[model samples]
Target: MTSPRRFDDRTDAGERLGEALRDRDVDADIVLAIPRGGLPVGRAVADALGVPLDIVVASKIGAPGNPEYAIGAVAADGAVWRNERAFERGGVDEEYFQREREREAEKARQKAERYRSGRSEPDLSGKTVAVVDDGIATGSTVRACLAMLAATDAERIVLAVPVGPPETIAELREAVDDVVCLRTPSSFGGVGRFYDRFDQVSDADAMSYLKTDP
Candidate 1:
């Protein structure tokens, strides 16, 4: 039989995750969560650490007919990172990839503005910012977020997540100051499969998390 699924909810899991980070001595100036699902976890981290919580909106450009398979991801300001293997696997050519990227870039830009909603992004200059996410599966979106963070002059950029497979975590480590991942289960299938209630996080929900200042 399969082992019992872990975590009760995002908050409970996040609190446990926050405690783990504290134990590991992972501290930061602020906790920036990739919007929607990440917001709930980021809220717990920020609250546990007594820091502000913010959202960094990013979008994944997935291969057609395989929405879960990310070929690339786009963040605000038009930065993107493509997975060559994904392109090859998806049978996407350079011309098609470029065209798709431009389309997704615009979507990312629009999504970012919607998430920001006139809220000013905190200046990362001289600040140690912690980038939090609910989890990582493909790492494409996380890479995009890291790319955006890199553009800022943050003194330190930390990637924190409740869970991720080992391979993806390893690939992501090179992009940030430090990665604080709590769980890397061998049976990792997807982020949603690990969550008890992995519902779709709407833009309104994302904005609510930001508006709550959690």
Candidate 2:
């Protein structure tokens, strides 16, 4: 088995990703992170690129009995990405999916509202946007986010992550204009395994990063 490259933490991973984006000359107008884990990484990327920091909220639609197994995901604006194969494999019907989609979409909307704290949503009309995430696991959430972005008038959309499995990254490529993944190891496990300090970030701590004062 191949050894996975480890990052000191989300901040370290973000720095590496930011450097990669800069090296590739990725010009972005705004950095929308998927919190609460993505905030630290987003802060680093936004600072490096001199862009405003924001968030793109989404929620997973887990399997009927197994909440951890994501069958799909829903975004704040009701955009969705359904894993047809997983849904078929889990024998999930359209009725159940519709119910969960509405529930999860509302949750995503509320989360986005809370994160924005009364700020108006950014106008992505004819601008390049980067959606930042700590890493990709199943990619259900990120896929949903990309779908939401697709509905906007944004000129381009980029999905940026520190690490993700090669296959999943390949699948994601079809959903966005560009993908900036720092590492795609062959012998992939969970995202936490590649990080030395993968602690659960608190909402308060995550919100602090959104502040402009530093």
Best by TM-score: 2
Tell me how far the alpha carbon of residue 194 in candidate 2 is from the true structure, in angstroms, after superposition.
1.1
State the lDDT of candidate 2 residue by residue for 62-90, as single tens digits.
88888898888999999999989986675
- Candidates' RMSD to native: 2.9, 2.2
Tens digits of lDDT, candidate 1, 1-214 = 1224576667766787778778878778888988878888888888888888887767788777777778888886667888888766657767876777788778877877787787777888989998988889888888988998899889999898888998888889899888888788877888877778878878787667777673
Model 2, total clashes: 0
Cα RMSD for predicted model 1 = 2.9
Residue 183 error, candidate 1, Å = 0.7
Off by over 4 Å in 1: 1-5, 88-90
* 10 residues in a row with least lDDT, candidate 2: 1-10
Give lDDT per model, in order: 0.81, 0.90
How accurate locally is residue 134 in candidate 1, as Cα lDDT from 0 to 100?
86
